[model samples]
Structure formats: structure tokens, C-alpha cells
Target: MTDVLARRVQASPDATALVGVGGAEWTYRELDEHVERVAGRLAALGIAGEHLGCLLETRPATAVLVHAAARLGCVLVPLNTRLTPTELDSHVERAELAALVCGADTADTAVELSVDVPTASVDDTEHTEITVLDSVSPAEFAPASRDADDPAVMLATSGTTGEPKLVVLTTENLRSSAVASAFRLGITPDDRWLDPLAVYHMGGLAPIVRSALYGTTVVIPGEFDARATLNALERFDCTGISLVPTMLRRLLAAGSLADSLRFVLLGGAPASEELIERCEKRGVPVHPTYGMTETASQVATARPGEAFAHTGTVGRPLLDTDLSVLGGDGKSVDIGETGELVVSGPTVFAGYYGDPDATARAFSERGFHTGDVGHRDAGGRLWVTGRRDEMISTGGELVAPGEIARVLRSHPAIDDAGVVGLPDPDWGERVGALVVGDVTDAETVRNYCRERLAGFKLPRTIAFADELPRTASGTVARRVVRERLLDNGD
Candidate 1:
């Protein structure tokens, strides 16, 4: 199709396009000019049609670069700002980037990187070639005409279990995803979506794309602050917002949410039933979603009013998307049978960047084989059990960590819970749990789980933590939990 932002500006030039947390606002026309100016600067640096790495925080500058990349026909590689220098280096090398862009917050990490590429800083005070939106004297420019299959952006998967892979999303993939999301969650011309997720994650990046396609507004807080987000909802008259369960929990605890909010899209990880119940009780309109990096942002989302009824279910697939639960023989399993989940549709990513073997293994004749295990009920609702790789096999019995974690969260004393397989000489691998709550006595929590879960599914070992480690997307970091258990000599 055509340039998303260019088309939006044509439709409604005076509509508010973006609002920063610090009271900075830009209309559609102004934002288009900013993107064009930034694209001109990149053109001067010979960055056209090349892979560019961006290590920036959530701000207006980051959104400008995202649109500018599309205009220049360059592949934008959104780097995670939370990654360490070593981790950043690995991604830079993997992408074979030609140039790098950094915001003021990540300038030090950009300098420390070993890659020998031209670097530009997006800070206004910094006297660099990339001085924030440096004027290039208004001139005639047009977005490069691109094929539908051309790669638009490359985002890294959350490497909770292993090394993250760079997913290559095509122009069509993004367009389809935005269109499908709008169809599922009706879009209004006056809709303003509040975004609090990091730009590196798909959850954050998709809103910018969707807003452009729908010609609407996106209000972004500088970062995720419970109080600030609550204020933003009322201040901006936000009709919709996206958040992880952790952020939602904090916001609910802060106080009553704004009545102006129409919908709260919750995902990034499996949401606990207790959390969903709390939202329902508070009159919060939450739509529990299930998606991954491979499927753009959301493949399936529960409807607004139906969320409380289906509690833990992620609802059905979005428009034009198909999902199936397959057995070991690669055939569709019966309803309510837990197996691997596979997705197929225009919204699916083209492939993993520069990894043919992985690209081949990830997809089959059926579709993209998501390594997640879940089932679909007769009513066609999907329920995610856990990751196939994360399953705990103890005493020759398989146990899903999500099943145990859900039960632990039901206890009034437990605020959050994460389960992992711990080494045990007797059982091969014993069920271990890390919990955050008021209760310090392990026996009391274990007894609580004993009533809800089966004997084999019960956690044999329990430890208390002030808070669990989380990735940038706010999902509990299982890998970190396993490492900490080893370090603690448990």
C-alpha cells in the first residue's frame, strides 16, 4: 500500500497525532513534517535502504525515527534499551547494521558498542549531525514506493528461554495486523490510544503503526508510571490503552481509574484469573489478549463485555486469522485437548532475520508452529497453558507452570507467583515456586496450593521474594528465576 503516515496526514492534517508526557503535542501535519526532516538527515548520512539500529527510550523522537525509516525505505531495528552492553553487541553484530541511532538516555551504551558504524544522537542539546530534527530547508520529497513483501521493521523476540531471534516483519504484515486489530476492536475517528510500553517491544511499536493507519491519536507517557498513566487517561480523554498485568495491578491499587477510558488491552503474558476478577469488580473494561513477536502484536483478543465471563481465555482469533491446536502427529486435536498452538494469516511475520534453518523449523505446511501449549474449547475460545519448552516433568508426570502459578495467585496472601523446574535426584525435576506476597511461611502457601492443584502439580519447594524479575515487556523472567535459584544454593 501507500505510506501510512502520508495517507493519514492527507486525510486529517489538523487532528492531534501525538501527545508526549511533558505536555508536548503534535498534530498530523506537524508530525509529518518532523518525520520528513528526520528522514532528510538520515539521507544525508547515506542511510537509505540499509539496516539501522536504534537504541532509544519511549519518546517523541523514537516515534519520528520509526516513520522516517518507512519513508526512506530503510529497515528499522528497534533495540531494547534495557539490554546490557554485551547483549546489545550481540544484536548489532547479528543485524550487520550499517548505522546506529541513540537517544540521550542510551548515548553511553552506543559509544561503548564495539561495532564500527556511524552513530547519531537524537538529543537536542548534543551538537551532533543528528541534532533532534535538524532543519534541512524544506524541499520536495516523496516516500519510496515499496513492495508489500519488503521488510519494514525488525524486532527481537523476548529471550526468556534462550537467545532472542530477530523477526522480520514485511510492509504487508504490519498493514494487515493494524487492519485486523481495528476490525476486532472498532476504531473511531476520535479515538485516542494511550501507550505506556517500551518501543523496543511489539506491544509499544504497534500503536504507532495502528494510529497512523487509522488516522487517530496516540498519547504516550515518558515511561510507565501508574499515577501518570491514570492522569493521562482523563487528561487526554483516552478511549483506549494497552498494558501488561503488572502495570494494571499497580494502577488498580492507585485508585479509581478514569471513567473516560473505553477499553484496556491487556497482554504481554498470561494474566491471572484473580487479576481479571479484580478489574471486573472495579468496573475496568479489560480485553485479555494472546500474542507473540512472531504474530505482530495481537492474534487473538477477548471482547470487552465478554472478558469477565471467559476470565482466563484469550477469546478467538482476529479477523482473517486462523489458529489450531495440534497433536504430536501434526493433526488437529479434539476440542479441549492441550497441544501446540499454530497460527496462520497475513499478519504473521515473513521469517526470522538471516536464519533460514530457524525460519524453516518455525513454520510447517500447517502454519507457524508456535512453541506454546494451549487448548481451544468447544465454544472456540483459546486458553494458553504454558510454553512447550517451559513444561516441568517431575516424577514422570508433566506439569504446566501456568496452571500452578494461576492457583498460587488465587491465595489472598500471594500477590504473584512463578513456577520453574528445579533439579531433584528423586523426581528428576521437582516443581519449585517463587512467590511475592505477605505470607513468608512456605507451608501455609503450599497448603493453599494443595487444595487447588493435584498432588503432582503442587510445588514441592517455595521461596518468597519482594518482587519477581521482569523483562522489558513486563513478563516474569523465568530464565532469571532459574539462575537465581542456583545461585541461592536451593
Candidate 2:
């Protein structure tokens, strides 16, 4: 297939391609020109067909680099801007990067990184040994003919449980994901998607690809400000949006959603019933989705109205995708029986980069082992229970933290909650909770959990906090919460 950008430009050169938070706009023709220019600069650096690390925020330049890499057949490695210099260095080494690209926000860190790659700065500011990306200009060149199986982008896992692994996605994988999403979400020619997610993550990267493929517009904010996002939704007449649960909560609290917004793709973490109820009551269309970096972006996504009816169900697997609930014996479990959720499809990632053994271990006869625990109902809908590794074994009874966290979040006063296993002498591990809410009374929270959860599943100790620690994608950072509990001797 032709490069998505080239195809989009051919189909509608005058259509709105991108809208920056600062009111900057780019038509398809203009965006394609910028991509070619960036591709030219990359070729000038002699980094074509190499692994290019991008440490940039959600801006037009970042989008340009993403497509430029595809045009040049270079593997785009989007580095998380939130990572420390040490973390960035480790990732660069692990990915075997040939060059690094930095925008204004990450220039200093790019310069500070220990990697010896040829670093290029998008901003006008000069770094001692970095090349200015804007200075180089070359004759336009045709987009490279990339095979469907050629790796297009490499993303690192959240690394909440262990060291982050690089997941390499091919051109076909991304394309399949984009197409499946459009079919599931009902894409239109004039659809505009609002993207406020970090550009490094799959949640952010997929939208750019989806918009390009659909010949639609994507509005990206400079940063995720609730009020700013609301304004952009109305101003851009965005037909769709991607957001985490926290972002949705803030937007709902700030004001009403615009009628122009048709669907809100909520993922990055599970959405609670309370949060879903709030959106339903406010006339906000929210589709709770289930997916991971390994599956491109979304494997299963509920329709907005269906999500409102089903509450926590993430819907069924998308067309061309297969999902199964497998037990410990690697066999399919009965319906409504909880097990590890495994997925298989064209959209599934190739494997971990440079780690054949790990990749082999990640896949079973069924497909890619998601490491997530969920169950399928008789209606064919999937319900996420928790992570396989995150189950708490207290007093020899296994308990899913998500089950308790869901109940805790149902409390009228609780805004957010994270459950983890704490070290204990009597029990192997004790159930513990960190809650974010207006309620200061820990006893009241515990009593609320007592009403809904089993005795063993109930949080042995509950701590109230103004907010819970979350990863860049907005999932409650269980490791961070566990560390806080350990540090406080709770």
C-alpha cells in the first residue's frame, strides 16, 4: 500500500490535516510538504533506515517526525518525555538507536543523554553537538516502499512491573489497527479526532495514523488542560476523542461536553462505574476500551451507547481480532470464568525488539498473552478483572485488586482508588488501598468496602490521599502506590 500520508494528500489535499492547540492549522497538502522536508533533513543526516528516537511533546513537529520516519523507512522510536535522563539512556541503548530527535521541551535531556547518536533539535535553540533540524533542506524525494512486515514503530512498555520491553509494530499492524478502529467507531470523511495524549505512547501515536488513513483531521493540544480540551472539542468540531479516565473526570467536572463530540475513547486504564455513570448523566458519549501497546491501540472497544448500558464491559474483540480467556493450563476457560485474556490478530505486534526468547514466551498457541485478567460473558462482551501478576495472594486466597478498587471508586465520596498487596507477617501479603477523595475518614471508606467486598478482599488498611500516583498514560501506578505504602509502614 502507498504511504498513508501520500494517499491522504492525493485523496484530499485541501482537507484539514492537523490543528495545534495554539490555533495553528495544517492542510493535508501542507502537512505532507512538512513531512517531506523533515524526511529530507533526516536523509541529510544519513539516518535513513535507522532507528530514530524522538523525544518530543504532542505538537505538529512531533507528528511530522512520526510520518517522516515512515516515509524514509526508518523505525520511529518515540521516547517518553517524562523519562529521566538515565531512563532515556537505557532505552536508547536497548533500542540500538542511530539518532535522536528532540523538541524544545526535551532538548536539554537529549543533550544530556549518554548516547553517542547524532542528535537533532527541532527548536531554534542550539545544543553543543546537536544539528538544527530546520536548517537542512533537500530536494523532495519519493516515499520509501516499505513492506507490510517492515517494522514501522517501536514502543516501550509502561514498565510498571519490570524493565520496559520494546514492542515493534510493522506497517501492516498499524494499518490493520487503524482500519479496525474506524470500522468499530464509525468513522466519517469529515471526522476530526481530538488527541491530548502523550505522543510517545500508542494511545497518542495511533490517532495520528488513524487520521492519516481516514483522511480526517486530528486536533492536538500543547498539553492536557481540561478547559482547553473542551474548547478545542467545540472549536475544531471534533467528532471523536481519545482520553484516559482521569482526563474524562476532569472534563466532566469542568463543564459539559459539546454535542459535536460523538465518541470518547476511554482507555489507558479501566473506567469505574461511577465515572461512567457521570458521563452518561452529563450526555457525554464514552466508549470504555480494552487494549495495550502490543495490540497497537485498541483490541476491543464498546460503542458509546452500549458502554452506557453495560457499564464496565469493554465490548467484544474487533473484527479480524480474536480474544480468549485462558486458564493456568493454557486452556480456554468457561464463559464468566476469569482467566488471562489472550489476543490474536493482524494488529498484534510482531514481538519484543531484539529479544526472541521473551517474544516466544509472550506468545502461546492461542496468541499473544496479554498478562491481563478478564472474563467473557454469555453475550460475548469482555470484562477486565485485573492484571495476572497484580493478583494479591493474602492468607492463601487470591484476590483481584481491580475488583476492590472498582468497589472503592463506587463510593460517592471517592474520586479514585488504587489497591495493592502489602507485606505482612501473618498473611503472605495483606490487602491495602490508597484512595483519592473528599472523604477524610478512612473508617468510612473501609466500611463502604466492607459492604461490597469479601472479608479477605476488603482492604486491611485504607489511606486517604488528595490524589493517587499515576503513570503517564493515567493508569494508577500500582508500584508507586506499593512503594508509598512500604515507605509509610502501612
Candidate 3:
């Protein structure tokens, strides 16, 4: 792994390696030197092809460390910066991280975790010790090469589903994801990608892998600032950018993006057709994609409109990935029938780290048993339904709030909608919606949805607001909404 990847850097020393937040830049030559130095540090601390943990911001240094770790054959565990100190500590202990590194911003919290490992402050580390941005031959000490089967990332649960569980992914898993993404949205040498999504999440971390593999320039925003991302697009003359549906809607609604861009990858959360159409109408090349942390990044994406158009479809699977809709009996469902979307591919994660029971539960011998419910059309395009656990049962009827939200979005007056299940004595659970836009238009919007949605599926109640609750990964927090609605006695 280190030999091949490091040679690539050495072969193109003069090439611009990367550019990121806080006014940082690195050419291939400089990046090679930096990686070697950092690898030296890791080796000096006896951290080899073992687990090395990190809590850092999105910056040039973070990218350098990733490359360095790969060279050192060390398993990289990126701790969520947003997690509490206790949460961070638990992950470190779970990964058995013998050495940890943190940026100046997160060092205190890392310390609070009481990690027995040697910890270093990356941000405050003296830059003069070796070289800041200078060309040097790659270090002589090369770590053992890791095949596609070797673990590259060890991700833990976010506690959204009880306690966090570890998800270990191999190099092949990440490479396959990067490869699939590049195929979906044709990677170009001249293309510069902007990723403002959180680094701790798969949504954000995937970009680093994608760019490194492709030798493409990725312009990373320090954080997810809508305006800052907009500014960078103009400033860097960036060509391609990845965004969640929430960010794309915000950017489009902001109406400040330039039209010079080629492709804007929209994923991380399901989006209304209205949002996708708006992006297309704005002359912004929009490709709606679908992916999860378990799948690396993207599994499918709408192909440049060369493919047939369908409402709410995430498009067909890219090369080398197989997808099927399976019924409750673990058999394939008809094309139009809804079932659990099962995926088996090189990109699938190895197993849940340290949790054999969870690992067994998450993956079948055939493929990953994704709890995500979806259906595949005759043309092979995948359309995601709501999660099985999130499905609402009302009066002996099964209702998916995502279906209602999609219908509500068709209303011209409705900006955004998030549907949930609310307690109802008569119907066990009634459908409710939290919408963004004028509450006065709720009646007209309800009428609009009535045209397409069945009576049992139409929301019985709607709470209008300026925005809906969102998670770091860009998904609307349905459980959070349930809690809020319960607290409000809605």
C-alpha cells in the first residue's frame, strides 16, 4: 500500500497535491516530505501497522496524516470532533489505540478521554523540526503492504442506534467506493472537488480517499459554512463539488453559486425531485446520488440525463456493485416490489469492529443486510423507501413518511417537508409532517398531497417551521423529531 501510493507521489513531485482551509497548499514534492516526517514520528512512537487514532479539524495537516498513516500501514481511527469527551474516550478504548494525535483545537478533549496512548498536538507541533513544504526523497522505511482485504478505517457507532459499534473497512472497500464514485461522476484531472461535510462522517472522509486515488485536487472548507463553500467555488475555480441534499438546497436557495462548475454531487440524504430540478434549472450540473457509511460513499447516481427520468430514483448501481431488493423471506422481490435493499460488493465494510454479534447481524454470507428499505424499478434504478424501523403503522395500514414527504414537496409553496409518526389513540400512530415554508399554506399543501397520497398515508397533522432537524451526515433526525413532537404534545 505504502510503496505503490508513495511512488505515485514521488513520480509527480511537482504536481499540486492539495489545497485546503486556513490558507494551506501542498505540492506533490512537499506532501511527500511531510508524509515521511510524520511517518517518522509515528514510527518513533512505535505506531506501525497498528491502530492510530486522531481528533483533528479539516486542514492540510489532516490530509498529510492520512497519507502518512497509509505509508506506515497504521489503521486510522478518526474520532468525531462533535462527540463528547466521554464518547471520544470510549471509541479510543474500543479501538485499542495505543497512540493518538489531536489538533490544537481538540487536544483538550482528547486528553479528557484518558487515552493511555502517547498523544501529540498536530496543530502546535513544531514545523521547523523537518520541513514545512519542501521536496525530499521518500523515507527508506516502508511499512508492510496491505492488500484490498486489509483494514484501512475503523469507524464506530454514533449511538443513534443504541451504543456505537465499530465498522472496519478494508482498503479495497474504500478504493471500490472511490472507483464507483469516479465512474458515476467522471473524475477529471482539471476538476477540483470541494468537500465541506464533516471529516468524521463517511460523507466527508470519502472525498479524501477519492481525491488521493485519482490524484485530483480537493479544496476542503475548514468547516461546513454554506457561504464559505460558495466563496471557495468562486475563489478556486473549482469544477466538481460534493454536497448533501441539505447543503445543495441551501446553496441553491442562496442563489450565489457560479455556473462554470461541471458537476455537483448531491447525496448523504434523500432529496425531493423539486430540489434536483432546481439545481438542473440553475445550469448547475446536478447528480443525485445514494450512499451510506456502510457502503463507503455512493452506490448509484443519475447519469447525465442520458438515462430515463424517474421521480425519487437514486439511479442505477455503478460498475462492480450489485444491488437487489429482497423480501422478508430473503428472496428477491419483483422489480416493482418494495423490500430491503441488499448490497454485496468490494466496497462493503469488512465487519463491525470488536462486536461479533453486531457484525453477524449486519452482514449475511451473501451480502450486507441493509435495514434500509427500497425498491428497484424495471430499468434497474433503485428507489429508496423509508427505513423498516421508521415505518409507521396506522389502522392496520403501513405508511412510509418518506412517501408523504415526497408528495408534499411537489407542492409549489412547500420548501421542505419531514414526515413522522405521532401517537394516535384511534389509529395507533398517525402520520404527521414538519414542513418548512409558510404555515398558512399548510391547507393547500395538504390538498396537493391528497392528489397523490392515499388517505392513510397523508399526514393528519403538520407543524410548519423555517427548518427541520438534521444530523451531521445530512439526514433529518427522525428520532429527534419524535422526541420533540412528544415533548410538544403534538
Candidate 4:
């Protein structure tokens, strides 16, 4: 369990471990061999207990390095490839990375970092000065044995608000997440998960670890084109896939689902009821999940049956996990009460990386304060409303953006919606909305909402956009939406 690849190879030596669409394929044994080589390369760079930063995308190489870092006993910091050097400077310094690894595409960005950490490259096709410059034989290196509580990866939170925190994920967190997800989703030896997500995020990285633990296959696509992803699903005989709401919507528009597909794990953001209904109509097994980087991946997920039954719920908490909705008084609220969501479990991360104060503020007596506002139903299904900080105080009445966005999405003409609070002179804040669809105008959309919403809940101002800004995980970037609204003078 310490060296997951080594153990996986021991258990299932010939099982398919990784499938690079139109590229290379590796069995568990081969993958383990490659991982050991990569770990040897890192060891040659003098990367010992120091944290290692990986500025790479979702590719076969990145997947190998993930296990390589674990094998070397170096805590991994999966740097976001989308971030600029300036945006990444703080994270690089905060993590105090000892050595940085880059792929062919991101090698230049790694050079741009202000920090003076040793850098290496892993471009298999080219032989540059930094490209796999050193190597050690498998007999020369020994994989470090890691405990369950050992920090595995220091992953950054999806910065929806233009601010991100570094969360420390342990082996136990990843193990618990994989086990619970497998129990809920059902896994088989032939299961192949088609992954199109960025490896820097938990959604993408989890599958790399989970597939090894399950002794299954991970199909890595070159890039996320709707047609390409759809083709890969069929070509690789993939049974499962992970996607955000936006990706799901686009994939549904692309083509029919592969008959070999078993489940579509839809998470990273809240999916509208319309989207879920569409999945149901298409006979797609969409399992809407609720999770964050702090929990490794999924805290709760609604299996297809439960998802269809409870359209908006994220389903029950996973095995060994506990969820509670606490009010302003910092006490657990009654069932069906809207309050701040609190999560405490083995799957939950220990704390943020290098931010003790922030970590202290994030947890309460119960558990990690998720800062997400939601409630549990009588059936114990979790319904996440919105962020506790995102609540719009329109004339002192708190309005959850999700509630209004749900109503707006219900409109037949409206394709999607994003709601936020705008500063107002009269009221402390006014409810504002940005919508996408073929609606006639903002007023028509407002009229549609007027029937369903109360006066304060109705949007004070509305704007139209072809698309709203979204984070990588597909969550609506409300901070960006708010800035856009302000710029538009809405």
C-alpha cells in the first residue's frame, strides 16, 4: 500500500494500468517499472524529503511522475498548468518545492518561476539537456514505504474566487476516497476509467491512484475535444468516466454514449436539474458527486438510481464519512435546514499546506468547515445550496444564488445561469444574474423568474453572455461574474 504501483504490480502484474489513446499502453508491471525509473531520475536530482512540484498536464508521463514522487517519499505539489508565473509564484514559495518537473509543453513556464528550485524535464520524444538526463537501474533504487497518514500530495483548491488554498492530501485520504467511490460505483477487473480532466486537480489525479488500487485501467485522452473524448470512450472500451457539468453538456451534444460505458461521474460543480433530466433521457448513468480537494475527491455521490430519484441531492455521505449542516450558532441544524456544511471523516484532509492560521479557521469543533452552505434531507441526501460567503444579502434577506439559478435554468429557453450579489446604494447588496441561452431578452428571463421568485429574490439586474467564466472543475466563477457585472454597470 505504501508504494501503490509496486503492490498493484504484485497483485495484478499483467492487468492494464494505463492506456494512452493512440499512443502507448502499459500493464501494471510495466507501469511499475516505468515508475521506478522515474523515481530513480528524481532521486538523481537530489529530491529527498523535499516537496516536488509537477508542472505538467494530464498525460502518461504525469501519471508516472505521480507514483514516482510517492515512491521517492517526496510530497507532490501538482501545479496548475493554466496559471501564469506571477500567479504561481506564491504557491511555489509557500510549498517550498525542492525540485520541479515539467513536461515538454510546460518546461518554459518552469524556467520562468522566480524561485531557484532545481528543474528537470521529462520529454520522451526530444533529448534536450534536461530531458531525462539521468537514470538508475531498478536494482539501484528502492521505493520508500509510506504510512497511511503520510502526506501524499499538496493539491491546490480550485480558485473560483481568484484565491486558492493549498490542501494537504494524505495516503489515507486518497485510499479512503478510492475505496468509498469503488464501493458506491462498483468496480471490476475490466473497468477502464476514461479521464479527460487536468491531472493537477483532484478529479483527474484521483483516477490515477484509484485505478492502480482497483487494478483497473485509466484511458488518457490527448486533449478534451468532445468528439475526441467520445471516440476514446468507445476505442478503449472504457466503463467509467469523470466530467464536469460543462464537459457533460458538450459530450451529450457531440454523440451517443458508448454502449461499453457504465457510469459518468458528474462532479466539480453543481449540475442543473435540466442537465440531469437530459442525462436520464439519454440513458446515461450520471452520478452527480459532491467533493473538494480537501476530501481528496468525493465526500458524497449520488449513484444513477439515487441521482434520478433525488435530482439535486449529492446523495448520502460515503463510507467512513460524516456530514453535518451547522447554523450561524455553530451547532448542527435539523434535517432539511439550510446551513453551512461541515465534513469530518478519514477522507477529509488534515489541513492546508503551510497556512496554520487558515487551517485553524477552516476547522471547528465538529470538523472541517467546508464553507459550503447546504442541508440534509429527511432521506439523508445532501443538497448543497451555495457557498456560505456567496449568499446575497438583498435588503437583509439572505438569498442563495443556487436557488435563483435553478429557477432560471428551469426556463425552457434558458440554457444556463450564474447568480451573484451586486453592490447597491439602497440595499446593502442586490441580486444580479448572468444567463446564457436563446432567450429573447433579459426582461423576458426576468419575467420567467418573477413568477417563481419573491421580490427580493428576483434579480435586481440581469445581463446576458454567450458563456460565463468557469474554473477548471467547471464551477461558475462567481467572482469573475461579479466583476463582469460591475464592469457592465448592471
Top TM-score model = 2
Of candidate 4, the 10-residue stretch with the lowest lDDT total is: 131-140
lDDT of 1 by residue, 1-490 (tens): 4478998999999999999977789999999998998888888777788898888887888889889888888898999998887778889999989888887788777777876667887775353534343543434445688899999889998877678899999998899988988988888889999988888888899898889889889988788888888898988889999988888999998877889887899999888899999988889988899998899889899986667898889989998899989988999999999899999999899999999999999999889998999999989999999989888999999898998999988888888988899888999998888889998888888788888888998888777789988875566798777776656523
Candidate 2 lDDT, 1-490, residue by residue in tens: 4379988899999999999867899999999998988898889888788899999998888888888888888899999998889878889999999999997778889888887778998887666687888887755566688789889999999887778899999999999999899889999988999988987789999888888999999998778899988898888788899998888989998898889988999999889999998888888888899999999999999997788888889998998999989999989999999999999999999999999998999998899999999899999999998999999999999999889989988988888888999888999999888888888777788788788888889888777777889775456788889887676523
Better of 1 and 2 by lDDT: 2
lDDT of the structure predicted as candidate 3: 0.75
Per-residue accuracy of model 3 over 1-490 as CA lDDT, tens digit each: 3433476675666667678775477877777777788787667666788898868776777777788778888888888887788767778888998677787677667667765666766665442332222233234566668787889888764555566777888888888888788877888767788777666678777777667667777787787777777888888888888787778878876656865587887777778878767765666677778777777777778864732257578888877888878888889889898888888898888888888898788877569887778888777888888877778999999887778888877777787887889989999999888877755555676687788988888777767777788654346777877766566522
Alpha carbon RMSD to native, model 2: 1.5
Candidate 4 TM-score, true structure as reference: 0.96
Q: Regarding TM-score, does 3 or 4 come out ahead?
A: 4
Tens-digit per-residue lDDT, 1-490, candidate 4: 5668888888989988999958579999999888887787677667766799998889898899888888888899999898888888888998889888887788778777887777787774253445453443333556687789989899988777556889998899999999999999998889999999988889999999999899999999867999999888888888999998889999999999798989999888889999999988999999999999999889899988889988888899999898888999988899888999898999999898878998999898799998899889889999998999899998889999989998998898888889999999999999999888887477787788889999899987888889988875467888888887787734
Off by over 4 Å in 3: 2-4, 22-24, 125-140, 306-308, 440-445
Q: Would you list the clashing residue pairs of candidate 4?
A: none
- Taking every candidate in turn, the Cα RMSD to the unseen true structure, in Å, is 1.9, 1.5, 3.5, 1.9
Model 3 is weakest, by summed lDDT over 10 consecutive residues, at 127-136
Which parts of model 4 are misplaced by more than 4 Å?
A: 124-139, 471-474
Q: What's the count of clashing pairs in each model shown?
A: 0, 0, 1, 0
lDDT value, candidate 4, whole model: 0.86
Q: TM-score of model 1 relative to the true fold? A: 0.96
